[model samples]
Target: MILHGYWRSGASYRVRIGLGLKGLAYQTAALDLRKGEQKAPAFLAINPQGMTPALQQGETVLTQSPAILEWLEETHPEPPLLPKDAQDRAQVRAMAALIGCDIHPLNNLRVLTALRQEFGADQATVDAWAGRWITPGFDALEVLVARHGAGWSFGDRPGLADCYLIPQLYSARRFNLALTPWPRLLAVEAAAQAHPAFQAAHPDRQPDADG
Candidate 1:
């Protein structure tokens, strides 16, 4: 398998964690998002959406982090990312969606660039724009995780929700969001970070990471 992605992309980060946790052996093709490498014809041929974290297995190509994650869980079920019970699985998916769908889309690189180039937003203004969405999303996540989580996001084992949460926390920190109020979420972050798989998949540990 070959995974194409950017170092700092949260969606890519999630897939990296999944691959690490699954102990999958795969080659990486890094796209320099800062240089508009994702828009290159070669990358667009793989993922017409021009997104990072496109996974290619033989002739089969998978786009979108969420779908890739589900494929990973289905193919490699030993260290399962989803819960056994249906209700619990739904809850886990909900938490993951809260971050993947609600929070991340607004703060991704493309949106931030649009804010600057099209909307006349300065760096500070862009930061504030990101915070405006992340804060409320995290506020709701804090409550949800506190109600359902154990040592990790959903339970004692690090699962799908943890994969989503840790990256979002990384983004939150990048935007200087206060996390002290979200103790449960912070605890989950600490737990996930302590795991070797999460550490291996961190942005700083990636081959293409900038400084």
Candidate 2:
């Protein structure tokens, strides 16, 4: 497997965590998003969307972080990411979606760049834009964590939600989003960060992490 990704991409971070959790061995191809390499014709041939995290397992190419995560869970079920019960599975997936769908899309690199370049927004303005949308998302997440979290986001065992939530929280802190109010989230992140898999997958530990 060849995992093509950007070091700071939260979606790629999620995939890295999944791979690490499963103890999967794969090579990495770092695409320099800052250099507009993702948009180049060479990369476009692999992923027409010119997106990071295009996983190539033999000839089968996978795109979209959520889809790739689900596929990984299906293929490697030992250290399961999802819950056993049907309703619990839905709950875990819903929480993942809350971050992957609701929050992440708004703060993606393209969106930030568009806000800065096309909309005449500055760096402070872009950070403000991410903070504005994420606060409500984090508020709702805080409520859910306070209600459902048992050690981790879904339960004592790390579930699908934790995989998504931890990385998003990392991104939240990266963008200077206040997390003091979300104690449950902070606790969960602390615990997740302790795990070797999650620790190994952090942005700072990635091959492309800048000094």
Candidate 3:
């Protein structure tokens, strides 16, 4: 399998963690999103959207991080990424979506670029743009986890939610998003970073990671 991704992409990071947790062996194909390499004709052929975290297995091509993660969980169920209970699965998916959909999309590279290109926002202003979205998304996440703080997001073991959460936390730190308000989130992130799978999947450890 070949996984095409960018070094700092949160969506790619989530997929990396999923692959690691499942103990799957795959090759990495770096797409320099900042350099617009994802839009190149070669990459476009593989993923029309030209998005990071595109997976190639044999003849099949997969895009979208969440869909790839679900495929991983289904194909390799030894270390299950989702819980068996339906309610628990919903909670995990909700937590993942809170980051993937609500926060991440706003702070993603393309959005930041558009802010600068279209709106003439400076670096500080663009970062503020990121904070504006992340703050509220994190606030809601903290509230949800406070009630369901079963050691992890859904339960004691790291699941789908935790996989998504760690990358969002990484992005928070990247943009200097104040995390003091979300103690539950900090705890969950701590648990995730402590795990070998997550540690190995960290952005810095990736072959394309920059110093």
Candidate 4:
């Protein structure tokens, strides 16, 4: 399998973590988002959406981080990312969606760039825009995690929610959002960082990571 992604992309980070947890060894084809490499003709041929986190297995090219994660989970189910019970699985998926769908879309690179190019926003304004969406999403996430989480996001084990949450927290810090309000979520973040899989998949540890 070949994973094509940017170093700092949250969606890519989530897939990396999923691959690590599943103990899947795959080659990486780094597409430097800063250099617009994701939009290159070669990359677009693989993923017409021109998004990072596209997984290639033989002739099959998979796009969308969530879909990739689900495929990984289905193919490699030993270290399962979802819960056994149906209700618990739904809850876990919900928490993951809260971060992946609600929070992340608004703060993604394309959206930020649009804020700057289309609306004449500066860096500070862009950061503020990120915070505006992140803060409220985090507020709700904190409550949800506190309600359902044991050690990780859903239950005692690290699962799908953790995969999504950790990357969002990393992004939150990158945008200078105050994380103190979500102590429960922060604890989960700390636990995730300590885990070997997450440690291996960290942005700083990626081959294409820039200083």
**What's the TM-score of each model vs. the native?**
0.97, 0.96, 0.97, 0.98
**For residue 130, what is the lDDT in candidate 3?**
90
What's the true lDDT of residue 32 in model 3?
Answer: 83
Please list all clashing residue pairs in model 2, or write none if there are none.
none
Q: In angstroms, what RMSD does candidate 2 have relative to the true structure? A: 1.1
Between candidates 1 and 2, which one is better according to lDDT? 1
Worst 10 residues of 4 by lDDT: 137-146
| lDDT per residue as tens, model 3, 153-173 | 777888888888899999989
Better of 3 and 4 by lDDT: 4
Per-residue C-alpha lDDT of model 1 across residues 27-130, encoded as one tens digit per residue:
88999999999999988998899988999988789999999999999989979999999999999999999999999999999999988899899878988998
Quote the positional error of residue 173 for candidate 3 in Å: 1.0
lDDT for each of the candidates?
0.91, 0.88, 0.90, 0.92
* Number of residue pairs clashing in candidate 1, backbone atoms closer than 3 angstroms, sequence gap of 3 or more or interchain: 0
Deviation of model 1 at 126, angstroms = 1.0
lDDT of 2 at 156: 86
Query: Judged by lDDT relative to the true structure, which candidate is superior, 1 or 4?
Result: 4
User: If the candidates were sorted by their lDDT against the true structure, best first, what order would they fall in?
Assistant: 4, 1, 3, 2
At residue 82, candidate 4 shows an lDDT of 98
Tell me the number of clashing residue pairs for each predicted model: 0, 0, 0, 0
lDDT of 2 by residue, 1-211 (tens): 9999998999998999898888898888999898999999988988999998899977788998899989999989978988889988888898889899899999988899888888899878888888887888888888888877889888787777887888898888878877897888899998987899889889998888998
User: What local lDDT score does residue 37 receive in model 1, on the 0 to 100 scale?
Assistant: 96
